[model samples]
Target chain A: MKKIKTANYDICFGIEGYAVLGQYLNEKKYSKIIILTDSNCNEHCLPHFLSNLPTHILFEIIEIEPGEEFKNLEIFTGILQTMTELEADRKSVMITVGGGVVSDLGGFVASVYMRGIDCINIPTTLLAMVDASVGGKTGVDLEGIKNCVGTFSMPRMVIVDTSYLETLNGRQIRAGYAEMLKHGLIYDAAYYDYLKDISNIDFEDLSLLIFHSVYIKNEIVSQDPEESGLRKILNFGHTVGHAIESYFLTQNNKNPLLHGEAVAVGMVIEAYISTQLSSFSKDDYEDIKKTIHNIYEKVQIQADDIEQILSWIKFDKKNYNGNIYSVLLSNKGKAEYDFLISKDLVIRGFKEYLK
Target chain B: MKKIKTANYDICFGIEGYAVLGQYLNEKKYSKIIILTDSNCNEHCLPHFLSNLPTHILFEIIEIEPGEEFKNLEIFTGILQTMTELEADRKSVMITVGGGVVSDLGGFVASVYMRGIDCINIPTTLLAMVDASVGGKTGVDLEGIKNCVGTFSMPRMVIVDTSYLETLNGRQIRAGYAEMLKHGLIYDAAYYDYLKDISNIDFEDLSLLIFHSVYIKNEIVSQDPEESGLRKILNFGHTVGHAIESYFLTQNNKNPLLHGEAVAVGMVIEAYISTQLSSFSKDDYEDIKKTIHNIYEKVQIQADDIEQILSWIKFDKKNYNGNIYSVLLSNKGKAEYDFLISKDLVIRGFKEYLK
Candidate 1:
């Protein structure tokens, strides 16, 4: 059992995570408990959660459609209205029991309801447990813009039980793994090197790796929770990655790339840019591309898609003063942020990724 | 000019407030400035505000319809969408120049835009200057639930210029005056005595009185920013007051009560509750009723409206554990909170208020 503590809340991994979560629910004496989950987790993970939850406190389960598409202002307002209808008072606590969409939207709703109530996150997906579980970031996408509306309200507790990871498919696990890989690529070369052997990641190895990834994220987030400076490093691949993700999600002509797949491709393109624009090694960029490509198949990006993606990049939350700022790797396990990336180089990076 | 400092920001009264505001804006170097105003303030006060704003920094004006009715989810999301369209970056600052509705909605928008941004509130109404100006509470209503969705994000600064009061009509001034009376009723007997001579409140007297109201509120809010304890005193009249306001707001049969007027009636009824339930004196309650009645006309509350208002009270944000919790006065300048109030007594108090 590993207990990782961030600035405001504590995270626990494995079965012990449930123990901590159950203990927290008992101590908080909340007026009632609300469990927010997506349809996917409602089917796969909720029964297990209810059985393990040791509180007799009245709990209600609210299920939304299971996908990023449902994460919008409309869904957020609907949940708030439902909570109101349920007469959920100020002291009520919401336990978000699913992946990132559930947690992000639930965390946001809980944070803003009555100017915030206590929330506990029990992330069921690998992507959520490894990435979204920490950092105190909660938001819903607005107008096809990802995370355009949000707040930095931490949950009362975060329970990252790895047993639920068994519920995820290989594609989903690899998508979450992309964040872990990017974490290592930017902060710890040795961790990256260890994770490079993409095949045969048994449950035990994945659990420890998830722990490492969360540790890396929390460490960065704690230093700059608002993403003022150090936290921007976490957006290393997300600059181009999020743009690509948004473009594909909105276009609907092709199947949308999962977050990690988009980010995996983003990391490769950024790494390529790093080699050309900064002191990053060409060999290292090639190595990163190879490792990510091993886990994620190459995404088909046509010329038109590139233009739309670049336009989305202009609205990247990380940018300031109308300039495109991208995080670049100076070397393996080290990154620099707020670099002025010209559209020319960004286009060239896309060209390199196409090859 | 009197400067009152709260936990996170400073509030200034009179002309010097503008000096502080101008200085802060020049120092922050925000990418852009977005001035948010309600329809009333946009027409009546914007030109004066723009002329006085001593900065060459680019600014855009976003206006919403003026009224508590407009303070809801649709408008909040609309402003956020407009912001996204304006390319309002995280570095942009929002200067809210209206009454409580504008400040509440705009402050919430700025706070949640990209998980928070800099916001400076320039409150343009007397009620706003004395009350809303100090509290970091920012929110928009959901489904007619007043301020149901919001945050505690403070402004970078607050500027209270009493000159704007000249633009308000007599009813508007009295409406705001009710909150100042609330500040006195709950915290300072001397201030209450001073304000009771309502007719002779010239500009100078109003300016100093507004300063006092803000000071008392700031002291209490600073001690308990999240309203876990001391801050609950601020909600003294708001229990019944808010219900009355909401009932009138949703029911178009009667003219909607301004926030302060609803609060004025709320304070009188709660004072009655205090005398019955706590150590409060009946004489003090009569004194409050007389003083309030002297300034405001009697509101006609039909028995049905009373029942509806009582039901609205059940959904009060101050509620906990499916119970109605109200702040009651023990005497003038003294109060207690989290007291469970019965429906029978609340109904009787409304009858007393009618009488």
Candidate 2:
């Protein structure tokens, strides 16, 4: 197991690491234990997770609906009621055992339950183990407003086991890889270079890359856990990426874009924005765009849709004092914040991504 | 202004202190501002609050239904949508302008908006200005649950204006006093003695008591912000008090008990429990009971209600590792934690309170 500690949070990554959950919990001596899971995890993932635990331990399980739709107040209240019914106390520990949706929702439930409680993240998906598990962000989306309600409560420890990835479909596995590539583009040029040559990799290799990405993320998060400074770099491609994700979501498209997929598109457009504002080298920018296009299927954006997406930029959480700020890359590994960009420039970048 | 700083939070209290909000928010330079209020404060309280602010500041006002009924997920989402439509940005500030209900709901909104943003409290009621405004605790109630969903994000600054209390009803004013009494019971014996002779005191003297109560609370919060140690003392009367409160709430009785009123009854009963188990003198317990009964009308808890309330005791936030731990006063100005009392003792305490 690899232990990564930041100023505000600490995370553990590896296989079979979940067995240590009871021991760490024993040390904290919480008055109660609550396990938060989505329906999918309860069926496919929990039995395997429970097999490693001692039978005598008494705890309650709160199962929420299975996807992003369940990550709202209605479901949040359900978990709160379950905790109250089970008599889970403030000294109790809440364990989130699922993917990004579960971690985000469960982390939020733990954050608000009695104004916050001790929480442990036992990520059961590749997407969660790599990206969402490292950050101290916990929240759920509101009506048409993604992640409109939430908090920043860090878990005491995060346990990641690669065995869960074996259960994921091919689409899920590919979706998870997109975020790993994002880590490489924003921070490590060498890691980006490594992903370019490979068409496919096993979970073992993916685990190693995930470990490195989490290490880099934890390092940045340690310096700025509240996303005040250094942490903004992590949003390199997320600005436009999130807008694209929301745009596609509203259309009732059958194949919903994965978070990483939206982020992948976000990276390309943001990289183009970086080139226009920071004068990043043309060759490096091309390489960044080409790498994403070559691996992920291209998403088409119409001119009118681009305008709508640009309007959504105003709602971006990063905007301060009404000015839209973008995290731009000066080079592969170097990022600059507070890069003021106008509507025309964003439209121009969108045209380039569409081309 | 009385400025009290603790390791986890800071409390600022005084009349006409709303201007201090500008200092903390100067760093972000917010564009548009949103102030959240309830129906009760909108008529008589908010105008006095707006008189102090600069006329040039751009802000929008959003009001919700007054009281605990509106403090739920439905209201939280409605406010979030309004903020989104108003184009509230990261640098946009949310000012909660009411009593505890408004502050708690507004604080929860600000905490989750864009994964957290800066918030300010302009508490109109005496209870909020003294207690809720000081601590970073922000939340809304779930289905029949009190403060079941929330976060602990500190406000930029708290504006305490005693001028608003001029319009407060007699019961509301008395409710705020009960919380002050709680501060004295847990931390200051001298303050408790001071309140003993307040039978004929004017409401103007409440400002001084508010300051002292806020100071004592800030001291204890600073020592243990997360409620890991000294903070437990703050829950002195809350365990059985909360159960009693929940019991009254679920029944939908004619006259719903206010938070402070239920707590007053809880303090009296818990003091009785302390007399039985700890070094607390029985005379001191009687004094506590008499002091509360003199100011507030008595709440009737039927004999049949004891078992139900006792069952709800398991849901207390203070429970740790499956044990129902109660915070009891050992003596005047002193508190103890993790007191394991039998079910019969609690039932007897309830029986005594009914008399």
Runs of candidate 2 exceeding 4 Å displacement: A8-10, A54-56, A200-203, B1-16, B23-28
- Backbone Cα, N, C clashes tallied per candidate: 0, 6
lDDT of 1 by residue, B1-355 (tens): 7788777888877676776788788898888899999888989899988888888778999999989999999999999999988899888999999999999999999989988899998888998898775688999877667788999888889989988998999899999999888888889999998999798789888888888889898888888898888899889889898999888998867788899899889988899889889999999999999999999988889898888889888778889888899999887888889889998888889889889
| DockQ agreement of candidate 2 with the native complex | 0.70
Q: What's the TM-score of chain A alone for every prediction?
A: 0.98, 0.94
DockQ of all predictions against the true structure, Cα-based: 0.88, 0.70
- Ten residues in sequence with the least summed lDDT for candidate 1 chain A: A13-22
TM-score of 1: 0.99
The weakest ten consecutive residues by lDDT in model 2 chain A span A9-18
Q: Write the per-residue lDDT of candidate 2 for residues B1-77, one digit (tens) a residue.
A: 66666564345656536556555555456777899998888888878777767545588999999886788878988
Error of 2 at B79 (Å): 2.2
